[model samples]
Target: MPFTLYMLALAVFAQGTSEFMLSGLIPDIAADLQVSIPAAGALTSAFAAGMVVGAPLMALLSRRWPRRRALLVFLIVFLLVHVVGAVTTDFGVLLATRVVAALANAGFLAVALATAAAMAAPGATGRATSVLLGGTTLACIVGVPAGAVLGQEWGWRSAFWAVAAVSVPAVIAIMASVPGGPAGAGARGAGGELRALRRPRLLVALLLGALVNGATFCTFTYLAPLVTGVTGFGAAGVPVVLALFGLGSFVGVTAGGRLADRRPRPLLAVGGAALLVGWVVFALTAGNAAATVVLVLVQGTLSFAVGSTLIAQVLYAAVEAPTLGGGFATAALNVGAAAGPWWGGVALAAGFGYRAPLWVSALLVAVALAVGGAAEGVRVRRRAAGGAGEAPAPAR
Candidate 1:
């Protein structure tokens, strides 16, 4: 909750807008670039791949640099990439820009998360994490909607300009607010730190995190076209639909943060189960305009509520590996981010229609819930054999 954290969040909002606004612009991008909608949707996957691959690479390469300087350099790269993206005519060039911008975004996010944690007043790292993540949640509300409207009024290229424009203010804030100190105490040896990935709990947490988000992007990535084409809402209604989802997301993260620390297992299991049911209901009733609209709000709330809590579980599970924790959790979510759109696109290409992704989403949620159940079952059996009342596991 520091002012500097807020500034970092502001910067994240700028980059995150570029990261997420493409969802709303998929149709326009496909039309302008003369590609199929599925091809256009792959851009989301490319960006996510960049995040998954680049966060750790960049973190390792820049480990010795001053925090403030690294942030500015990353933001500048981000801004330039958006500019390149705005002017590019070829889909290939635009696609490259998405990957590059995501790399820069990932680098900045990794650094900012470290900075936020380093600055937090003892045991408040979770709040700091939430404060930083709040930027992306906010981006979904303000920046993503504005991008859709801009794409509607002017063109999809203008949304890229908006991302670049927003970066200027964030750049100013980083220069003024962040300290010039080093990233943190130098990280421990590679083998010692790398061992954190071996934990069964961490691995499960990572997989569940990925599945939860995959379920979401399966439906969300194509919302623009889905609402316009399948639900009988006009193209102009796309942004409103997105805004409702964003509003629900805002509610979700707020509620999840309050309960996750105290009741993570129940929260993710029940919330994900609820989302599974919601997706089924949504697919069955999507033809009804009123039901579709109401379901968007309900599904959005359930998805983010569980999604946010699962992320927290991954973070807690990886507490021993400070350096790798953020990158791994990030990779987990972006794995879903990359996979969801590609699979959703596959369904579309195979003649499954817009509703196919909903079924895919429901299946992903069920898989995650089953994994959680099996893990819990093993833990229960082990505890009973070990003679009850064992100290609770670190991540639970």
Candidate 2:
């Protein structure tokens, strides 16, 4: 991997920290802004909505620009929004700021993934992507918890300030490290890219990415409640369980990247199956603390393992327009992020227990496996029809 890849990863870590820090600050924000907790929770949803919109919008706007320049511009805007968010006391203004910041975050990630894919040596796109995504997993482990502590000790505003402060070095690193050139410059315009999205196989790949993430978040969004209410753990232990999940995610992505490069189809099928099994087992044994903890680790690992492969699959499907491909993947994943929790909330409202989300998650993963199988079958048939003389499509 190149040093520039690490720089991209660092930038992702900063933005990811800002994105997820809101989860821990919702209570403080609600009290400070004189709003309900559910209202404050909307801030998180707002951010995901912004990502869903911003990914393609930013990709189209920056399609002609150098990748490095696009990344720098996005990071600058992200920093500015965090500064504004830190000073805003009005809930509406703060919510608006979250959306704006997420736009910048989404833009940065879209460009960075394309740039990373373009920069990697032959057959190493999956590894490069995994390296980039490692930053986000690290944030879940380190940055989010630290931000929560900062919010609790100093105030919620302090967490925004911390995000802004940390972003400064990421901006400088990108300026110094990332090469300036029209990377992915051959990508088609917005119209052509949109047409590509209409393709059935490409759509399936994108949907697979969404379903994989949706399944993960469906259970994960309610994990704290499940840990305390079902497993009988104390409040203080919630962070520990989350950290364990993050650790598993980090390991899974690292391993999944290598496996994806070698065999994306098998990894996708096996990872999805593991996730489905993990969720079913979790739902059944959630009352046992030890079983719950182990299942959490398994779920985290399988979810991320599948996620990385799905991303690689999408990238391969949209190889002709890498930046737009990345944008599509990001948008699909964010849509899942927003939808999964909403569905889980609906289940909870209908009087399902905390474990209900796990069952829902299992169903989602099973759907993903079916879609993935369909995709694989299509690829194999296409290869067979072309005869043995023609090369098969990439495993993704």
Candidate 3:
């Protein structure tokens, strides 16, 4: 892998820390803001909503610019928003800041994915994309737990301030290391890229991405509550369980990278099934501390294992427009992210217990599994009609 790739991952680590750390901060935020826990959970949805809008919009705006410059612009905006979020006392102001920060986060991640794909050696796009996304998994391991500790010891605002501080060096690293070149210089214009998204295969893949993320976030957004309320842990134990989840995610992403380019379809099927099983077991065993801990690890691994393959599948489906392809994937996934927590909140309001979200997750994953299977069948049929064998194609 290139040094630039790792630098891009570092930047992603900064943004991802802010994104996932909110899960751990929800209880503290609710207590400080004088809002219900469900209301505090809406902050995650608000951030995801911004990403749903920002991904394609930023991709269009930055289509012609050099990748490094675009990334820097987004990172600076993200850092500033975090600063604003750190200092704000008003709940509305804090929520608005999350939206703005998410815009920057979405823009940066879309371009980073496109840039990483462009920089990869032949047949290594899946590996390159996974390596970039590994930052998020690493954030789960280190940043999320650290933020939880900071929130518990100091205040939730301190966590945002910490992210802002870390982002300064991340910005400098990207500026110094990433090459100042237009990524996918020959790629289609915004209009042409939009046209590419009209393909059924690409659309299905994008939807699948959304469903997969929705499934994960439905329960994950409320994981702090689940740990403390349902799993019989104290507030301090939240970070430990979250760290276990992150460890599983790190392992999953690593394995997914190695397999995605080789067997994306089968990987998606198997991973989706495993994730569904994990959710079912989680719902059934929510009251058992040991079972919940083990299932959290299993769920994390299964959920992330499909991530790289899903992204690669979308990229393959939209080979003519790599930047827009990446943006579409980002937007679709975040749409699910936004919806999942909102739906989970609804379940809570409807008098379902904390474990209800796991059932929601399971259903979402089931739908994703079916969609993935259909997409794979389509791909196989197309290949056969064109006289191609069942062998996987080399990554572009």
Best by TM-score: 2
lDDT of 3 at 246: 87
Best by lDDT: 2
Q: Please provide, for model 2 over 1-396, each residue's C-alpha lDDT reduced to its tens digit, 9 standing for 90 to 100.
A: 988888778878888898888889999999999999999999988898899999988877777788779999999999998899889878999999989988888888888888888888878888998999999889988999999999999999999988888888878878887878774666677687778666666688788888878988888789999999999999999999999888888888889889878887677776778788888999999999999889888788888888987787677667777888888889998888878888888899999999889888888888878877776676678778883321112433
Q: Answer with 2 or 3, whichever has the higher lDDT.
A: 2
Clash totals for all candidate models: 0, 0, 0
**lDDT at position 144, candidate 1:** 81
lDDT of 3: 0.83
Q: Quantify all predictions' global Cα lDDT against the true fold.
A: 0.79, 0.84, 0.83
TM-score pick, better of 1 and 3: 3
In terms of TM-score, how similar is model 3 to the real structure?
0.89
Please provide TM-scores, in order, for all candidate models, with all chains considered together. Answer: 0.85, 0.95, 0.89
The ten-residue window of minimal lDDT in model 2 covers 387-396
Candidate 1 residue-wise lDDT, 251-369, digit = tens? 78777766766777777768878998999998898888999889899888888778777666655665555545666677778889779877888999999998888888898898988
